[model samples]
Target: MQNLLSNLKITINEKLYVKDPETSELGRKILKNSIILIDEIGFESFTFKKLGEKIQSNESSIYRYFENKHKLLIYLSSWYWSWIEYNLVFATHNISDSLNKLCISIKIITQNIIDDKNTPHIDESILNRIIISDFSKTLLTKDVDTENKEGFFLVYKRVINRLIDMITEVNPKYPYAKSLASSIVQGALHQHYLKDHFKTITNLSDKDCLSDFYIHMIKKILS
Candidate 1:
């Protein structure tokens, strides 16, 4: 899988950036350090100027890649989902059994993320923390409707749609595949958040147990 992903380039929406951050060394530095800096400080307090300081570049140079912090957050979210979609596709492509495929897909989406040594520019483990903690800011905004129209959330939706298809295949008669699929993805994030912050309300105290809980619930619901 590492070899397969060695050459992978996760595409982000062009509209989310003023320039392609993957195309230059300085651009890549912006991306690499931005993820680290954002992980160090929550997104609400993150700014291009701070990111620029971390990268030792002029603040205006950061704007050359992103229009603002909001767009950068959306770019990061899009990139994260695209990476997940890649893993989901590669992991499940060879499995013929629908339920088994769905189970693996669930594990892929809901399981804890670790850094992939194959992608050096981005620390997926840290990025996963950002997704779990701050991904909502990318969507729960006043511009979400307009951004949705612009397809800013396309990769994220595609991830859910893949699960939707898998769910339908597992149980063709299941009528709520869309809702269930969306819930599984969103719920996984929420559960992880609760496990980290509001532990009293969630039984998913263990990282591995989180996946098991969802797999169990999904089986019961689809069966």
Candidate 2:
């Protein structure tokens, strides 16, 4: 991890020393502490008071970055999606084949979901946070104050758009390229969760029966 940080031009100092302003430093500290707290204490158990004690900051300082636990959770959920976008885009950029790009994109996303170390509730938390954004309730409650209520959903929409760009060609035979790509992504993700969450009945892990199913769905859509 230290080597990776160094490679990214991040110094491996035991601590951050921006010396810019207390709020700036506190923001980083709070985020780091929140991540650790979420991992160790579970996000549901995480509290601003506890975070302040862990990071040696007051709750007021913590509120500067995130007004509440839900807002912080929103950040965490969106961060994962942003990370998925970064990794998938990077991994598929060198591949010249459109079909390969689509395959690679879905595979990377599935692998990410399966490989994440967070607890199952983290995924649930993501959906809850997205729901607030979906209905603009986060802004309605005066907790999060983004000018555009749909900012987070826009990120998801952009990901779907990128999938289209990667999957569809300049002169494609498929009449419904974008919609097909959306369906393929939706099927792969939904099937993965359905199988995992209902493992008792389905006896399927994310990709245990999913890869073949997804490929068939893709073929049917493309055909």
Candidate 3:
């Protein structure tokens, strides 16, 4: 499993980074530690200097891989969605039941993070927290249009597209497959935030309850 995971490369769009962090030891450290630092200190407080101090590298070296914290944030988000797409394909590939496949997809997307020994460097639990809290900041920027042109969001779009395909398969006449897929993804993000900051806003009492909530909502919509 370690060998397979080490071999597995979740590629981010080249446009998102000035240098590919996955290609070098220091680059990998930057990626790994950046995730940790970003989760420790919110993105607004994260900087290459802090990351450099944490990883015992220079800020200029960090800049070689990512032009700025914003680019790094997008790169992280893209890597996450790429990982999700890979798992979605792996998990649902042979399932014949449409609803079952959808349920598995929900589980994969909504379930709380569990660290895989195979990927020792990435603490998915922390990364998931970053995603839930900071993912929107990637697009809620003035450069969103410019970044969109560079395909910085393609991997995320691919995940949504894959989910939309599954939804269409289960309900051919459903007119809002795209909307519903986006809702499921973003809704999960929002609920995670609410669970943490405004508990009463969402009934997602615990991480395990998330999958149940989304699956039930999907069933109601499809019914």
Judged by TM-score, which candidate is best? Answer: 1
Off by over 4 Å in 1: none
| lDDT on C-alpha atoms for all candidate structures | 0.91, 0.54, 0.87
For residue 12, what is the lDDT in candidate 3?
80
Candidate 1 residue lDDT tens string, 1-223: 7678887988888999999999999988988898999899888889988988888889999999999999988898898999999899899889999999999999999888999888888899999999999999988989899999999999999999999999999899999999999999999999989999998888887445877888898899989
lDDT of 2 by residue, 1-223 (tens): 3233223321111111222122355665665556667666655577999988998777776665565676565555455555556657667767887777777777755442432333222343444223322323323455344523536444545667887776566336666767866675555555545564566555345336555555556656665
Query: Which pairs clash inside model 2?
Result: none
Task: TM-score each candidate.
Answer: 0.98, 0.61, 0.95
Candidate 2 residue 152 C-alpha distance from true site, Å = 2.6
Misplaced by over 4 Å in model 2 are 1-25, 39-45, 113-150, 170-196, 201-203, 206-212
Deviation of model 1 at 196, angstroms: 1.1
Candidate 2, residue 119: the lDDT equals 28
- Which prediction has the highest lDDT against the true structure? 1
Q: Give residue 122's error in model 1 in angstroms.
A: 0.4
